[model samples]
Target chain A: MNESLRNIWTILKRELTGYFASPVAYVFIVIFLLLNGFFTFMLGGFFELGEASLSRPFFNWHPWLYLFLVPAAGMRLWAEERRVGTLELLLTMPVTAAQAIIGKFLACWAFLALALALTFPVVGSVYYLGHPDGGAIFAGYVGSLLLAGSYLAVTVATSAITRNQVISFILSVVICFFLILAGWEPVTSLMVRWAPAGLVELVTGFSVMPHFASFQRGVIDFRDLLFFASVIVFSLFGTSVILRGLRGA
Target chain B: MIDVENLIKEFGPKRAVNGVSFTIRRGEILGFLGPNGAGKSTTMRMITGFFPPTSGRVRIGGHDIAEEPIAAKKLIGYLPESAPCYSDMTVNGFLRFTAELRGMRGAQIDAAVAKVAGLCFLEGVLHQSVDTLSKGYRHRTCFAQSILHDPEVLVLDEPTDGLDPNQKHEVRQIIKRMGQTKAIIFSTHILEEVEACCSRAIIIDRGTVVANGTPAELKARAETAGSVHLRVRNVAAETLKSKLGSLPVAGRVSLQDNPDGSLSARVFPRDKSTRADLSLSVAQTATQSGWSFDELHTEEGRLDDVFRAITLPDSVKNRE
Candidate 1:
């Protein structure tokens, strides 16, 4: 168990350092912060909600924002290794596949947290202006994190399938978009109208909306947490399988 | 110690390594000599556990590569061809990461990194990013990473492929020193490198082992079908040709006119014969006819000749 933790730490440290050592992480943080702020205030019309709270404005656009920006952060996690022939070196190292996948995913997730943290001004502004439910604000951030983690997990799995960064990014975004849209009321209603009742329920359960909705409402449900955790675990497991197949090949 | 038994690797219909097997004892430097596409890299990859063989098994230090890959890999240090490394990391950072991945911690990691850095002459470039370094320095950094953990078995594929002559010499010297305590398997297309560095060589061609022996043994095999080149002066071409033709050792003698009024004759011997007998016959003829023997030297067969002779298409088909 100690050795496994050490391996995780080693992979995490190397991945985080790789991010900061290059211009990629900084560029991602700056672009994500700028876009999030721009869409929340100017485009999302936070004042129109009229509650002097960022709950609606900030949390409303996070799904769409992560749909694009998260791929940028997560696309190179495994794809670049395959591209540069370093995947062989990494896989042949004395670490379990799960350790490598988790370590890399957590490092990128930490970068996302850093980017979210820089949006503190938005939270601070909401606090400074008027009365708002602090619990809701906290829950909103949790939901965003879970949502980001889920997307990154999927992206990491897709990245492991190919060496081309562009293809990984595009495929991840499309897949995440589908998952997000599948949970939207209009899409689920349409599926319910046309498809069998059981299939509609399954599709709705698979989407990010129902689970994210609980967190958005300032409630941390066990089922919702399990939903996100299971997604992360299952996707990483798939990534490991793909990598093992590559090594076997 | 390393043992590969009946290892086979196939890519679709193309057989990359076919029932290939070999063994390397401790403290021996075995050179894997072959041309391009001769399955040398494929075989090394299998032994290093980067890829599993389609069949058979590899045992490194008594640990089966397939059954106990981590244990086997722990005993081996591998440097793949072209020495690919991360370009973003500094030399020190890369080495440290590699050491950590190999399960070293704290002072052990530091000491291992320092030892390898010094061994590969990477002290000056330790802080510099790998992308900014020259090719020789990059190769050295990769070399340093490979030996950072001091494994008992070392596999280097084309270790000196891109270095200049001076750099090649330096790397060869380092390898020779390291071979004292480790079993080293290095592959290269340069036969001169084998002659200079390897105690034994395994020559492969067309995805199969063609010959395996010491450099001297291979040279001796080539000498059995040797040809001689001679330069004689002041002798009529017909007389010299007839004299060489009459010798028992000379199978086929052909004379050519030289620019300096000397006649050069090439003598093919049916069996392995020393140059003394051919020299004696030419010397006797020159002494009796007042001719001059400018040059009478026995041709020593080289590794290149052996490689060419053994890997020829006709010879390969005949071996089957």
Candidate 2:
């Protein structure tokens, strides 16, 4: 167990440093921050809402923002390794494939978390403007991070499907797009107009919106947490299977 | 130690490696030689635990690779064919990462990285990112990573493929020195490298072992082995051929006219295994004929000839 942790930590450190070694990290952080500021202040109309809560303005844009950014950040997770032929070097080391996958996922997730954390000034802004439920704000942050994790995990699986990063990125975005539109209010209403009610509910059950919305309302329901955890676990597990199949082939 | 037993790998309907087997004890260097697509890389990958054999087992230091991959891999240092490294990392960082993955502590990681860097002559580029390094430097950086752990078994695939002549010599020297203590297997298309460093060599063709022997033994299988070549002045081609061919020790005598008007004759032994008496008999014949000769020597045979004889298509081999 201790050896496994050490292995995971070693891979994590290397992967995390890999992000910082190139200009990708800085550019990603800058674009992420700028986009968040733009959506929250200019488009979402945080001032017009006249509410102390960040659910509408800041947290609401997270799912869409991550739809693009998370895939971009995670596309290189396995694709670059395969393209550069480092996958052999990595797997031949004295570490399990699971350790390498988790380590890489956590590193990219932590980078996303850092970018999300950089939005702290907005949290401060809400606190300054009016009294707000700190628990609710914290819940929103957790939900946002989970949403990003789900997208990033899906990206990780797609990254292993091809050695080309662009293909991985496009695949992740298309998959996440369906996850978002499935439970989206307008899409559900459109489905209700022509489809059976059970089918609509069943499809929306796969959507991430309802789960993320509950977190924004400060309800840390176990079901919602389970939904996000399962997404991460399932996709990472798929990544490992795909990697093994590639080696086997 | 490295032990590969009846390893077989199939991708769909195509068998990449077919029931290939070999064992290397400590302090032995086994050179893997083969033509293109002969499964050398596939065999090395299986031994290093990168690819699980479809059937069979690879044991490293008594641990079965398929059953205990982590433990088995811990005992191996592999330099893959492409010599891959993380281009995003500096040489020092890359080596440090590999050392840490090998379970070294902080100071130990630093020391190991430094040791391999010096050994691979990577100190100059240790601070440079991998993408910026030359092909040879990149190859050495990956080679350094393989030896960072000082593994009990070392598998190198074309370790000197991209190296200049001097760098190739240096890498061969390193492999020779390390082979004194570790079980080592390296594959190459260059037959001279096998003669230069390998204690034993296995040549594979079409996914199977075709020949396994020492450099000298394999060379002795060449068609020219145990043949004598004589260049003499004032001897007619027909006269030399008939006289040399008539000798009881000689099998076939072929003559060529040199541009300088001297006759060059090669005498094959009646029995290919006997090389000692062929040269002496040719020398005696020349002296008796009162023919002055500029060159008279026995051919030790050549590795390339043997390699081609076994690997080339049957029609091509017959034509040669």
- Candidate whose DockQ is highest: 2
Candidates in order, TM-scores: namely 0.93, 0.98
In model 2, the runs with Cα more than 4 Å from the true position are: B318-320
Q: Candidate 2: deviation at residue A39, Å?
A: 0.7
- For candidate 2 chain A, the 10 contiguous residues with the lowest summed lDDT are A240-249
* Cα deviation of B128, candidate 1, in Å: 1.2
Candidate 2 CAPRI classification by DockQ: high
What lDDT is reached at residue A155 by model 2? Answer: 100
- Interface RMSD (Å) of model 2? 1.2
For model 2, report the TM-score of its A chain. 0.98
Model 1 residue pairs with clashes: none
Candidate 1 stretches with Cα past 4 Å from truth are B223-226, B256-259, B272-291, B312-320
lDDT of 1 by residue, B38-137 (tens): 8999999999988889998999999998898778888888888878788889999999998988988789988998888887788999999998999889
The local lDDT score (0 to 100) that residue B71 gets in candidate 1 is 86
